[model samples]
Target chain A: MTKFEIRGLRADVLIGAEERQEILKGVDLTINSGETHAIMGPNGSGKSTLAYAIAGHPKYEITDGEVLLDGENVLEMSVDERARAGLFLAMQYPVEVPGVSMSNFLRSAVTAVRGEAPKLRAFSKELQQAMGGLSIDPAFAARGVNEGFSGGEKKRHEILQLELLKPKVAILDETDSGLDVDALKVVSEGINRARATGEVGVMLITHYTRILQYVRPDRVHVFAHGQVAESGGPELADVLESEGYERFVKAGASQ
Target chain B: MASPNLGITEHSHGAGEIPISKLDTHGSFDVNDFPVPNGREEEWRFTPLRRLRGLHDGRDIADGVVKVDVQAPAEVSVETVARDDARLGTSFLPTDRVSALAYQAFTEATVVTVPADTTAAEPVFVRITGVRQGDAYGHVLVHVRRHAAATVVLEYSGTAVYADNVEFVVDDGARLDVVSLQDWERDAVQVSHQYTRVGRDARFRSFVVTLGGDLVRLSPKVGYTGPGGDAELHGLYFTGAGQHHEHRSLIDHNVSNTRSRVEYKGALSGEDAHAVWIGDVIIGEGTQGTDSYEHNRNLVLTDGTRVDSVPNLEIFTGEVEGAGHASASGRLDDIHLFYLQSRGIPADEARRLVIRGFFADLINRIEVPELRERIMAEVEEKLALHE
Candidate 1:
């Protein structure tokens, strides 16, 4: 029974060194455990910014906002603090950290969130089981963290983290992009596994409706002009998929 | 492609690249050949000459004293021979002023020999401790006979200003592994040159770890005697505040069917910490099927620290398997930090993990389990100081 809320979130991002561009303007959303919310938008509509802003990325400066998890201020938390506070972001482009083995990174992350390191035997068994569930090769545990991972492999690794970290709120940013049908199915299944736990509030960001076919969303929101322009039940996704975001863009620009 | 590369088609016999390559390096046994460096020469520009404690010049060289202790398996032989012994300089000659000065100053040299066709059951440990009264010089030779295999560990410690030359002669079909640990005291300064000649079908691997010193500089050079020789050079260095560490290596592929690989990693912290790595690989003419690659990486932990990494590759023969060089030096990547922190690792712990991973690759290859753990513990201790 976890509740996450974002009210009037406005954020600006630094373009180079001095120039700042406002990407998110008055974004409002709420997600509860056992519910999946699909964030749909056109290119440059600030969908990714919303995800990063909520995850506490330094690039996204929150000018005016209130993000709370269980009534605890999330926007005030540091990036790691936000994570330890049960917020996770599956980045669109997960960084490749050379020389860091996957086993070590996952263990460190789990220890930080859990406030204590799990027993070695139990942890290894748990890790092998989770990786097996995703059809990932056990050999990858010894390899550098995403050092030479393919696009789909990187996506699968992100889902693997979600399955292990078990955060209260998870934001999957473009997890379906660059994924083939087979990989998309595998990733969708991983998300569904986390969803079945009834403890994770999922915010799925995407530009397509393909992933929604596998993991149905409870609510759909159309984002445009750095804010939500339309919100409706799951049926709204069908209309938007057929009619496209042209009308929402026009309406947002007119506003 | 931007370099003036002499492809095999340009001169099939490798005539165009032979003379120019030979003229680039000037090795001498005479000290006068290399004048006193004024901190302006290409080789001395990055080094703090004044902090060298006169190891670079002839001043109070005999006032210091160094004691040597050797522990070896029963199969190996260790002896102190006069400088005039025939096998003293058979492998290579002095290439710098400090090396030549050490050659002219040392009275006796330690020679460790592994008998032909015998594999030593235990490694040979050469422990060198010195006093910082003035200056000292030393020389050591390790010879692996035909079909023999051996491992040698040279441990340097105590406080002293020292210059020395170390040579390794690997016979045909022999295998040699050497680990040179420079763990001197805070006020110690040392300049050491290591030269190796790999015979036909011989294998040579050397690891240089520099962790403690005021100013430490080491140069390791390898040359092939015949074809089918292989060499691997691995190094790790940690520079703390007010300390300087430099490593220079050269691999000479003069024969055909030769292979060489060099990898060096360093981490620097605190103010005035400096690190320098120079890798030089030369593929000479008439050497076909030569495979070589060298890379240097540095991680700067604190502000006001500096790192200079340079990789030089010269290929005269184009009909080779592969040849490449890479060098990088910078602060810890922000993206790397972000990636770790995004996973819930605290900022300080994330930094420590990244630095540990940076050196783990080289440290894991140390072969000795105890030594590997000790190195990691020492690195962690250093990380704790500034954290």
Candidate 2:
């Protein structure tokens, strides 16, 4: 079954009072359950914007397009409503909340999304298992969320949330940045574990093809100038890796 | 001035009542005799002296009984004492220290004591109410003896046109947990001071919530008198339209091996609502092995709101294991708020939950359950008023 569908997705960025320029111009994409798709793009190509717009961020205005989650209209819904409907966005730069402990934050978020209080014993057990899978210290649960954490720790924490919440569509936006080899391996492993549920669909947004080695993409698409310029099989990622985004930009300019 | 009713008094022996004109020339510590200096004065630097000048207007003393509501546990004792009580003695000062002495001359004070080596099973509640339009003064002195442990809730409410002072002390080896609630009327002006001394192996914890009053100033000072002493200070302040709340804290470590931690959080909204937090930690010489940490975090909810945070640490000895301080003032993080809202929580509810969660760590640190619940309820009321 199709997990998420984007039809004629058009988004714009308002720089100043009167400057309304297009960022994601009439893009279209689709992802099915149990499938992983990679959107490779250069800088300023609306990769993060696409993730944010799909997550219902207030700052991003969807001028024209329709986003559907299992055939349900998502643009009309609020940020949290879309989240409850199983859309999750792993932020590129997660915020640091000083006094809010990770455990308390996750508990409140999970409860709110589930519309019920999570059982204590079951929740703790699941949390412990997820933390172990991500190689995160159990003590991290007691600390504030994303406060003074390293880049690797933040990415791992994002995956920790994904593992625990088990959302249907997980949007990973540049999760591979600033990670060492070992940290990247652990993070990709965590993503694979999250996808092991079989019902979860993954959208991996990245600039480098290194992460693709661990979590192989079923389909790869080249994104330039705010829209997908080319869609092909996994071999396309390897070709882009060798030639870099210059060829794709030239192709986009010619089109 | 001559005494009118003294008949056949053989030569006045007492310090003759100075003439009202002479009283204006530095007779003791009179607020009128001393000039309200500019911000150049060290003590007056951070104080809102410009706003304080309004007290000079002919605002009469607040009259009527001030009602106090206590929500503490049953085992905790409560009592109201008269001004002449021997236990209170001359420790209670009625003078404004800045204005008229007669304004608070008729005030009654309350004293709460937890005896030595005794641990109360539940937290105690003590509320003081002020009513009418005349002056009112109150002195609260608390004594916690060695090996004693108790949580005390001191709540102040009412509408008064005068100033108030609160003083307390925690003795050696005693554990004192105090939660002070300041929810006065809009027209009221309050100046409250709380002082605590922690002795050898003793612990002192204080949680203050400021959510009311047109102008309020709370100064809390904690002194570590002996080695192995510890103190924990947590405060939360919420100010709405036209309200000004200021919190000043001083932690003094005089002995070695002492430890202290302070965390103060504030939220300000509405036009011209201002909040300030000033934290000072003084680690004296010979206070080696001392560990101290101070942090102040403020959240501004509206465009016109303002918050100023100053966290200062003066360490005299380099032998201390650790000493650090941090201060931050900004609006709520958009991503965290959006993350919460994306999960089906409305924008308002999301903001409220983030705030509630912000204080959850500090609230959970309270050992007494009853006091924790009361603090939570007070926070709820403050958030409700935000709507």
Candidate 3:
């Protein structure tokens, strides 16, 4: 099992030569391969920043932190180098690349991570299978990456990348936000399938326990005030879902 | 009262409200008729006058600087004839001064003729190269006979101060595709005008791809001889540091039942890299049932680069089928870069992918794989300079 560790991570948004606001104060977490950890939080809780800082996002300035994947420094790696180091981030809002098609984008990413371009025959077959697995339209292969795509389609596309890139540790940031019932099921099944391989670690971030009903997390983390306020098992999700995060927020505020 | 535009395809024309009336472009082809521009004229406003290299003033006409070579199939005939051969200026007169000077100064004109009803089995290729030559005037004429379908490519390269005139005539029922690539060396200065006439029920299409040159200013005009003519003009260009590339297009729809589409996409990087695109469509009297749409888009890759795009439409009567024009320019999308980098692709390669994707749609229309790959490789080379 590959061990992924975040020790005393802190970062800020480096927007256009100005690092004005800090997001992650100090975050600490660890996940091994074949494990699923869920990072749940309310809006403005800095959950997204945690994901971005760990992935070496340029916009995020990591003031004090260390993101280690199997004892390797991810913060010291470039964005693509971080990915090649077995770290993946499925962003809540996937950007639209106007000219590049989904097939080309996926192939490029696969080549970058694998250090070699995938064979045409194998790539084509694998792409088609992944599209089928994600319940994505076959026509999307030629369409521009996330261009003019609906919210649900974008979420499904993120999962499709997860199924293809096959990173050792995957950080899914709010993957369940905009998906409809059918799309949520399709996307959740995609996540579960990736985990079933037993070689990948899953970190699913969300606000509600809705997607948790489908892809159960082995560990549940309640995030507040830029760090984990509480951590427990799947039962913790039920408690947060039924009773709400009012107590957790108050408890975090008291600290 | 009802809306004039009820068709779903109306949206394809884009949304923006410019005057439905005409804006006259101030200059004519006659050497004496066009007054000397002091950077105040409508056409010369955006162009840097100092960079024109005296081609605008008829000061330099060094003819033998660039070598012209042609490789074509046997079914077609290539000839070098004088100005009064009765074949010159059959389609239209020059619309600008530099082109007129090129017409007046050139002693010999290269004419490639395709016989009527003969579909070409191979493309005609014209290669122009200059070895740091001083200055020159050039002219090219393409005559496609009735019902014939032919493709021609004019490849320009090397160094020179050049002005050129290229004319195309598509006879009745004939189809013509002309691709002009201005892949000049970094110090080349070129000004060119392309005039085309599409005959009854004929089709005309041209791809003007500009990849190099210090300053390249080209204007292409299209006119129809009869009804049912179709014209598609697609162009792509890239501007680097200290380079100025300007392209202007005019499609004339004076007859009934004709269609015209113009689309141009460009990118600019480096400090002071500039690009300009002007699209003008005039639906004159008797032009009923005319469908025309033109769009210009620019991607600014760096901080100091600038792009100016103007899309104009002049509709005479409401009897027209549909007409519209639109233009937009902006910087490289940040979200796009982040998305690609997050997926393990390096930032530099991701940027290239984004740019390559931008031109893939139009480049795919080239039909020939080798040519498409060749042009795209040059584009890749330009991106390497940045990332």
Candidate number with greatest TM-score: 1
**Alpha-carbon lDDT, every model:** 0.88, 0.75, 0.85
TM-score of each: 0.84, 0.68, 0.73
The alpha-carbon interface RMSD of model 2 comes to 2.4
Reference-based lDDT, residue A30, model 3: 94
Residue-wise C-alpha lDDT for candidate 3, range A20-100, written one tens digit per residue? 687788899999999999999888889998988788766778899788898998888888888888889998888887768
| Model 3 residue B197 lDDT score | 88
Task: Tally clashing residue pairs in candidate 1.
Answer: 0
Minimum summed lDDT over a 10-residue window in model 1 chain A is located at A52-61
lDDT of 2 by residue, A14-54 (tens): 66678777899888999988999999988888999999888
Candidate 1 C-alpha error for residue A88, in Å: 0.8
DockQ of all predictions against the true structure, Cα-based = 0.53, 0.36, 0.49
Which tens-of-lDDT digit does each residue in B1-387 have in candidate 3? 001221212212332432123323333446766666677556687899888878888775474478788989999899878877788876666655787787777767889999999988888998878775678877889999999999999999998888888889998999999888999999988899888888999999999999999999999988888899999999999899989999999888867888999999998889999999989897866468999999998988888998989887767667888898888898666667777988899988887887788877678779667789998889889988966
lDDT of 1 at B44: 82
